[model samples]
Each structure stands twice: as structure tokens, then as C-alpha cells.
Target: MIILYHPRATRPRSRRLPLAVLALAAALEGKEQYEIVDGNLEDDPTARILELIARHKIELLGVSAMPGPQMVAAMETSREIRRLHPHVPICWGGYFPSIYPDAALNARYVDFVVRGQGEDTLLELLDALRGNRSLDSVKGLSYKDMFGLRHDNGERPMKGPDEFPWSPFHRLPVEKYLGPSFFGKRTAVHHASIGCPFNCSFCGVHAAYGNKEKMESPERTVAILTHLVECYGADSVQFYDMNFFLREDHARELCDRMAHLNLRWWCEARVDIMSRYSDETFAAIKRAGCAMIFFGAESGSDWVLEEMQKGITTQQTLEIARRTRQFGIIPEFSFVIGNPNDPDRDTRETLRFIRKIKRINPDSEIIIQHYTPTPQPHDAGGEMYGKIEVPFPDSPAGWAAKEWMNFTLRIDTNAPWLKRRTKKLIDNFEIVVGSRWPTVQDIRAPRWSRIFLQVLSAWRYALHFYNFPFELHLANQFISLRKPKRESL
Candidate 1:
């Protein structure tokens, strides 16, 4: 049996999550051989997919999608696969499908839609498929019957973080998968835990993992790290956890173990937690070979922070950034460009904040992201606006095919003013980079090659910036611009 996982679009280098690891775990459960064919990595033409299907006798195709264009790519790929090999069952799973299972299930190309925490559910579905049993018994799956779409009630609870399978780095061509920074150096990723405790409305973590926090035991986490270093010769291991250091004790213990291993690594942590950690603990973390840390410093405006329920004040975020630098650990701070309540004043304040931080800590790197609003199951006024709906087909096969294409556009037609202002803000903020940072010198290269690389990088950053505020603005406009005769939601 074969399980193919599609990563996001192939563009200017984006990191591929450990989908191979999850697919391996599911394959192990059913005692099936699996290979992760990244569509983005190798352009999958009709002939290529057909050749693989015939060679491996593939029984299942599982496609995963991130937001925006990737969703469309996934859907299109599923449709193509179905056209070539209709017998092979296709399953759609990921953020987009999970959020809009009903719409996804109704699509023409998807055979099954797995919502939320897919590891266990995927295994279960595969088992049933192997047995030639009815898919209705599969929990967390949406299928279509002769009548219409059939969604199984309730999602399977996510497995404990410890239960997650170890990285399948051994199976993948690690050298090919390595980032530019990993050319001669080894790189690996570890997930210390699953889910975040915070309920930031703009975040998808809460929607995907719920409000509960689940962490792997310190010993198990240490063992994983040890394996990565000893077996894989990992020079640097990136912690892929949404919030790696949520528990201070866990962070300290992991740091202690890491210190003994004497390996370089990086992790993401909340600013509030970092602020409360004792200097000794941070020192230990640095000793443990933590060379860098990324913080979600969403905004400089306190009001925006408060509105997002981020639980950290701008002052607290600044202090944490400062302290991390003081400890000699590289700090990469991320900021959101647009907020729901953002105005000209707020945008200027955020830019000023970015400038201040750059002045205070010359070593720190700032990553600015644009906001997009994804449709949640229960969003404010969502019900009145006819609940943000994706056009999912009723059949499992069709739903799987369309799963990736169903995303809310960045600008809703309903709010022209918001959309116009957002474009202006993005244009204005381009000035911030110029005013605050030294101009980047153009490197001499082949004319065609340099233009291609620059354009690619520009598009990559443009797509990465899409988040809630932008999506909401788009959705609102879409609703408002609809013909008056058309009913809402």
C-alpha cells in the first residue's frame, strides 16, 4: 500500500512539516509500506502519478493542505489523480478540510474527509478500507451515501503527545530535504508537545488542537532528541511545537538534558513564560545549546494585544526580547502587519515599535506577517452571515478532491474600504523596511536568474503574510457585494 502526502506549494523555499513521520506511523499501524511523495518537491504530472500508482499499486492517496493557494493545489491534484486512477481511494486531511468537512465531503474527487487529529483516525480508516468494511463506522470521517453527505458525529480526541511516532528522518532523503543552512550540517525537528493553552482568536492552533495542552514526558522528549543527535548526526534540531516552553519545568528538564548532549537547537516560546523564567533557567537553556528562539510578538499596540487575548503586554514582550539577546541566544521576533482594529495610527505605532526594537537589539531579526481571517465553525456574526461555508460536494471522493480549494479569499468583496486600506497599509509598511534598515545591495548575477529569484521571494513572502484580519475583511466584502436577491449563509 502507498500513502502519498502533498506538502504546500513549491515556491521559494518553505519548510515541509513532518508529514512523512505521521504517514509512517499510520502505515505501521496497518503493516503497510508507505512512501511520502511530496508533489511540491517533485512536480507530479499525470504520467508520474500514474506510473507510481501502477508500480506501488497504491491503494490510498492522502493530501494535506495549508491555507490559500495550497488548498487549491491539493484539490486540483486530487481531481487529476481521480481521473487517472479512480479505483485508488483519496483522503483529504488538514486545516482546510478539518474546518469545512461538510463542504469538503460533498466534493467530487475526495473519497473520505478526516477532520482534526488525523493520526489515529487515518489508521482506523485505512484498516476499514483494507478489510473492505463500511466507512460509516470510521470515526471522524465524512462520507457520502446514496442519499447525501454523511458526517460521523464528533472528532476522535487527539492522541497524547508522547504517543506520536518518532521522526521518519531515516526513511526520507535527509540530505535532499535539508534547508540551505543545513548544506554540510545536519538538521532535524522535534515536537515536544501538541496544542497550545491560549485562545487567541486569530490563531488556528486553538481551532485545531482545542484549548487543551498536551506534552510529551521529559524523558521521552530527551530520548527523541538523543536519537536525533546520535543516530542522525543532527547538528541542529528545530522544535516544531506551537509552544515549546509552556511548562517551565519541562523546559528546564529538556534544557538540562540538552546541555549534557551538547547539541545546538532552537525552539519557540511565549514571551510571558520567558519573562517569568529565572535567569539561571535561561542560562541553562543557552548552555543546553539553544542558539535561537522565536517569539510571537504579534503587535506593539497594547490594544491589539489585549484584543487578541495574547496574555502578554507589549512591555513584557520587549523585556523578553531584550533578555533573550542578553543571554546570547538569537531572538527572531514575528509581528503581524494588520489587526482587526488597525487604523493609520495603529499601523504607525507598530512600525515605530519595529524600529525601536531594531534600535535596541541590532542582532534580533524581525519577521512581519500579513493577517488573514479563516472561517471558524463559530465566529462572531457568522451565523447571521450564513456561516462561512466552503463548497464541499456530498460524495467522499468529491469532497476530498475539493478540500484544498475551499479557502476564504484574503479580501472579502463586502468591505471595499477595508480591502483598499489594507493594500495601502502593506504598501506604506514597505517604507518601514527602507527607513529602519539599511538598503540591501543588489547582488550581481545572471539578469534572468536574479529577476526570477527576486520575484519568487516577493510572492512567497506575500502569501505567507495572509492571516485573520485580511481573511475577515475579504469575507465581509464578499458577503456585502453579493446580489441583493441572493440569500446570506
Candidate 2:
């Protein structure tokens, strides 16, 4: 039996760890002969799919898709697959199908949708298919019955992140990927932990991984990092965990192990974790090769934080920013504007928060974001669900680079001025960044072209976050980021 997975690629030139594909690959290890195919690594993914179909006698095909435009792309692929090989069953999984199982089933080409964590769900599904048994017993499996009735078997228990065999990264097209990360060294994305401790309503982290985190052992984490370094020539790691510092001891242990490897790394933490760290702990984080840390300071206003149930305050965010900068780590904070409670005022507060962070860090990076609602309203009754000009893109790169990415203006807001400026910047971004979607080549564009793009990005942020003139906001930004107070420790 052969199984195939095509995770929509984010960039034509870059591919990070596709954990869903990897996890499924790990499960299939030694059980069957299977090939893992990446869509992002191809010039024409459909043609590649056709080539694979012609070559392999596949028993099962699993295609992962996210919500928005990616679903369309998956639908197209499924259509093509059904046309070529009518007997092969296609199963769809990931964030899109997890919540909208019934809706996803509307696409006649999709044979099944695997909701939530897929390792166990998929394994059970493959077992059922082999025996040709009724799928009614499979948990987290959603599909339409032969009579066209919808059947959703509900969520399967998630296997711990560490349970998946060190993710057959060997099967991935790693050599084709370069550093599109913080350190700008050959980078690999890894998750030492799964799940988030907090539930910020707008976030889907809770939807993907429940509130309680399931983490790998410190020793396992080190081994994985070492494997990536030795095997993949990766010098940097992006933890990509929802919240890595939830346990200070766990973090410190990982840091000590990381220090010996001398590899630069990045991770996300909550502002509340700042209270858990002393000056020495922060210093240790730096010494351990943690070059960057991100905090989702969701909103700027105290009321907004209360509304989002973010559970962290403006004060905590400020304290963390100060400590991170003082300890010689690059602190990146993200804020959400346009929460239901006072969208205009929320944006203003977010702006203030960003400015305050700049004042604290001066030489760090920060993101001020407008809240983007999912294509389908997550809330049935909330403020008539703010609309967007276009549904989110379906491709992996779309997920990586657009509005939610802190780059383009994809979502519309109540604030008139914010909407206007956002539209302008987004239009300009399309012009400068996309000869077709921007590539790493765009990053290396001529100085004037890069400056022009920044000029556009700068004005958009200024218009939304700082009430001051765009020129003044740009000036303040330059002054704040101009000089490093100390040499890299």
C-alpha cells in the first residue's frame, strides 16, 4: 500500500517542517512502502501529482488542507486525482475540515475529512479501509454515507507530539529549503511542545491543540535539534510552539542543552511568563542561544485584553519587553486590533502598545495586526461577522505572507481611516512584492525597491497604530531602531 500527502506549499523556494505530513509518515514507518510528496517543493504541483499517480499503485491518498483558498486548491487536486484514479480514496485533514466537516464534505471529490489531530484518526482509517469495515467506528473521521448522509464520528484522542517518530524529516525535500528564519542561517522548524495554556478567542491554537500542552522530554528535544543540525545542516531552530516558557524549568533545561550545541533558536512565550523569569534567567536564555522570543500581547487596552480573555495585561507586556531587551534578546510582540469591543479604540490601544514596546526595546521587531476573522464567522451572533474583500488564500504561501502575516491588508475593519490606508498598502504591496507572489528574490531586490516597499509598509502601520502623521511615525521608528545600545552579548 502506498499513501500520498501534498501539503500546499507556502513559498516556491521554501519548505518548512510539514508536521502533519511528517506525523503521518512516521505512523506509516515500516508498516507500508509510502512516499511523501510536498506541493511547495514543486514548480507545478498538479503535474507532479500526475507523475506520482502514474508511477505508484497507491491504496490510500491523504491530502491536508487549511481553510480559505487552500481548500479550493485541494478541491482541484482531488478532482484531478478522482479523474485519473477513480478507485483511490482521498481523505482531507487539517484546520479547515476539523471544524467544518459537513461543509468540507460538500465537495463530492473528497472521500473523507479527518478532523483535529490526525495520527490516530488516520491510522484507524487505514485499518478500516484494509479490512473494508464500516467507518462508523472511527473517531475524528467525517464523511458522507453512500446514501449521501453526513457522518461525523467526532474527535480522536491526540497522540502526544513526542509520540510521532522523530518525524521522518529524511523524507522531506529539505535540501531545497534555505533559511527563511530569524538567524538567516540554514533553519529547521520544530515543535518541542504541543498545545497552548491560554485561550485567546481569536486564536485557533486551542482549536488545533487543546488547552493542556503535551511536551517532549528535554533530552528528546536536544536529540531532535542535534539530528537537524547533523543531518540537515540546520544551524538555527524555530520552536514554533504556541507557548514554550510556560514551565520555567522546562525552558531552562532546554536552554542548557541548546547552549552546548551553540545553535540559535526562536520560540513563542506569553507575557505572564516574564514574571516567572529573574534577570539571571533572562541572561541564561540569551546565553543558551535564544536570539528571539515572541509574545502575543493580543491587545493594547486593558479592557481589550479583558474582552479577549487574553489573561495578560499591558503592564505585563511592558515589563517583559524591558526585560527581553535588557537581557540582549530580540523581543517581538504581536497585537490584535478590531476586537468586537470598540474596534476603533482597540486599534488605538494596540498602536500605543506597539509604540511603548518600541520605546522599551528600541532595536527589536514588533507586529501590530488588525483582527482577521475566519472565512466563516467563528461566532454565530457576534457583530454580524466583519467581512473581508477576499477569503483568505488557499495556498501555503498565502497563509505565510498575507494580512495575518503582518505584511498585507487582507481584512477590513470598522475604522474608516484604517480601512483606507490598509487597502492602499495592500495594493502597493501586491505591486512591489508580487511579480507573482513575492519570493526570497524580493528580499534581495534593489535598494530603492526595498525602500519603496518599506515606505509602503511603514505608512500603513503608522496610519493604523500611531495617530501621528505617517512621516513622524516613520521618523520615530528610524530613531528607535537606529542604534544598538550594547554589542551582542
Candidate 3:
């Protein structure tokens, strides 16, 4: 038997389907026996894993992890599992391992690191484990040799979603993943594409996927979503693709196909790409029940955007904001402040740009994050951005430390370039703007609480005096104002 584990990543209420584990399970379907153990759904995933091992002749334990809190949980769980069942081979996959294979292997518990798309890599690794293939032949795999030295066997060619079987959703408790969201009473999530073509400096997409993206056929996408709606009663879906709208023709076809699903959806897109989209395509997207589009308007300063290798300009962001509003679809603009070069200037410009976005469309949602650098490979142009002198941790435990964990989440990066005063300004301004225009996506915040916050922050927001929002901070202590960056659709 094999076990696929999804380490706890978010709050239980925020947890959607474990698409990564399910994708691995799809590769194992009919050929091998495996069970999924999601830490998000279980109170004690380690104990449950031990129980499974005791009852079955387990062959391997694969853990899918991302950065931040999930990495912490994964390290702790894997360490305990190794302590109790040292013989069980443990493999790590997903964004964390893909980006930092050495750190993942540095943990004694992780025996293998599956790089890139793991569906094919995992199948090949399993074959190698069964003595049918050689470990060196397994592409997108990292394992220690007899001498205890690590070897990354290079990348595997990526395939489109159609190349693989649909996720083994039947094997999972699908109902448990359906939860309440502003979009619908029972919301589901799906990744209709693999990887992203853009190589943004602040992003780690290229680390795992390279500069490639392959989208599924609209028919295949709609069919799977239809099953979720009919069989699991999922009324809404949030596409987790890095860039959902690639081609205008593709978007038009997808929108046309999904119009009959009657499902409210949200997705991320590039502002420049969407700004170039025809009004008819926007209409189709809106008609298909697209409630919101999350755009990576990385910064307000054109110089900062260029520095980040983000091809979109601030004007394009504003144009999309105006365009999305015209189509009755909310534009959720996310900004990354505190650029390594002249962080103070970057922060001020981004904050001002966010306010400008709001002025263009009062319904626009703003998301702000501190500039947290991720390891990125040099692009085809031989350019790299967001490079810093700080040494990255060489072990999972080092990354799980409080400081690094915060860095992963982009809450407080502790980047050398960012100053305390700049951080405070960002924090205070965030509170004032967020309170002034409470997110429509936040169904949890009470009406009275929203009113109270709006009233308290009105003068501060109007005058742009966001120095010390003491009263807003105190009010937030009693009332949790959910930020768009932290919440899901």
C-alpha cells in the first residue's frame, strides 16, 4: 500500500480539495493501492498515518507540501513518522521541495524529493522502487545514493491536464471539501491548468513548472466541474490556476462552455492580458458568472514592475480596473510593496496606486503584501530579480522557524531593504483602506462591525493620515477584519 499525505496548509474552513495529492492518486489509480491523508481534515494526521502503516504493508509515504505553515506542519509530522517508522520510505513533493530540494533532503525523514509535475515523476519513481527501473533514469527526482549524497535527476517534460486522468475525487470525501464562500453556499476549487508561462521574480511558479503552461480543454474542464455540481452539490468554484486567462479565444470558448453551469467563479489573470481583451470577451466572462478576477498588479511604479520582470504597467492595471467594473465584475488588485531598491519609494507609490484603483472603481478589492523574495531561475533572457545577500536555510527545520515561516507567508519578510517605519506605514494604511472599503468577499464580518470600522477609519482614510491607527487596531483586536490576501473567494 502507498499513502499520499497533504500537510495542513490553511484553516480547516479555508481548506478546499487537495488537488496535488489527488493528482498523484490519479497516477496510481488501478495500478497501485493508496490512501490519502489530509492533515487539514484530521486532528492528528501523524497518528492516523501510523495507524495506516500498522494495518497495511505500506510501500511509500508521499507528503505534498507548500511553504509557510504547511512546511512547519509537514516537517513536524514527517519527523515523528520517521522516528516511529524509520523503514517507511518518505518522499516530499509540491512547491517547497521543488524549490528547495536540498533543504527538504536535509531533513533526515525525507528520503526523496519529487521535482516538477509529480504525476509522471512519481510513477517512474515507484517503478524504480520496485526494481523495474534505475533511479538515475527517473527524471524530476532527487534521492541519495549509497554514499548518502543527493542527486537531482533533472526535470521531466510537462504535459497538459488532458494527458493525465481526472483527479481521483471519488476516492476523497468530496463533501467535506465543499464549504461556504461569498460565491456560493458550497464552494469547490479546481486547477484546470498546470504551471504559468510568466516568470515573475517574486513568484516560484517557474521553479516547479519552468516557463510553460498547458491548459485543459474547455470540455474536459466543464465535465469535471459538472460532476462536482451534480454529484457533490458544488455551486461555486475557484480556479487556482496561476494565470487562468491566457488566450482571448480560449477564454471565450471556456466562458461559452461554462455559461450553462450556473456556477459562480473566481480566477487570477494578468492585467495587461485582460486589458487587451475585447469587451465581448469580458461580457462573456461576466455572463458566465465570473464574480471576480484577481490580477497581479505587482506595483504602482512602472520602474518597480519592470524590475520585478512583471510585464504589466500601472496604466494597464488601472485600465483593467475600469474595464472589469464596466462589465460588472469585481477586479481584485494585489500589490507587492517594499522593493529591494528604494523600498520607501516603492511602498509609497504602491499605496498611492492602490488608492487610485479604488477611486477608479469603488468596488475594486485591494490586496497588499510585503515583498518576499522567492528563489527564481534566470529567464531565457538571462535576467534574475529579487536577489538578496541573505543566506537561505539549508534545512526544513530552519525554514520552519518563526522568522522564515513569516517570510514564506509574506506577512513580515524581515527583508534587509524594508524599514520598520515603512512597514508601519504599510500596516496602518492597510487597516485604514481595508476598513473604509470592507471586502465584499468577506461574508464573515458582521454588518455592524463593518459599519463600526468604516466610521472609525473614515477621517484617517479621507485625510490620508495613516500614521497611527490606534483606535482601528484596538477595534480589530475585538473584531477580526479578514484581509483579501489571507481569504479565499
- Largest TM-score belongs to which candidate? 3
Minimum summed lDDT over a 10-residue window in model 3 is located at 376-385
Off by over 4 Å in 3: 377-387
- For each candidate, the alpha-carbon lDDT, in order, equals 0.62, 0.65, 0.88
TM-score of each: 0.77, 0.80, 0.97
Residue-level lDDT of model 2, residues 1-489, one tens digit each, is 555566563545446767777878888887878877667666667777667778877777888876544555677778888888888888888776664565567676778888777877778888888886669889878887779887878556666667777787767767566465546568777877776667676666676556678888888989988888888788877777788887788878878777888888777888887766877777778998888887888777998787676888899988888887778887766665666545667665565666677677765454445565443223223222333243443333344443434322333333333555544443332222221111222233445543543565554454443222445334434433211111010
Instruction: Give the Cα error of residue 261 in candidate 2, in Å.
Output: 1.0
Q: Which candidate wins on lDDT?
A: 3
What's the count of clashing pairs in each model shown? 36, 4, 0
- Candidate 2: list runs displaced more than 4 Å: 178-180, 374-489
Q: If both were scored by lDDT, which would come out higher, candidate 2 or candidate 3?
A: 3
Quick one: ranking by lDDT, best first?
Answer: 3, 2, 1
| Model 1, runs deviating above 4 Å | 11-17, 20-30, 40-48, 130-134, 182-184, 378-426, 434-489
Rank by TM-score, descending? 3, 2, 1
Task: Tell me model 3's lDDT, rounded to 2 decimals.
Answer: 0.88
Worst 10 residues of 2 by lDDT: 480-489
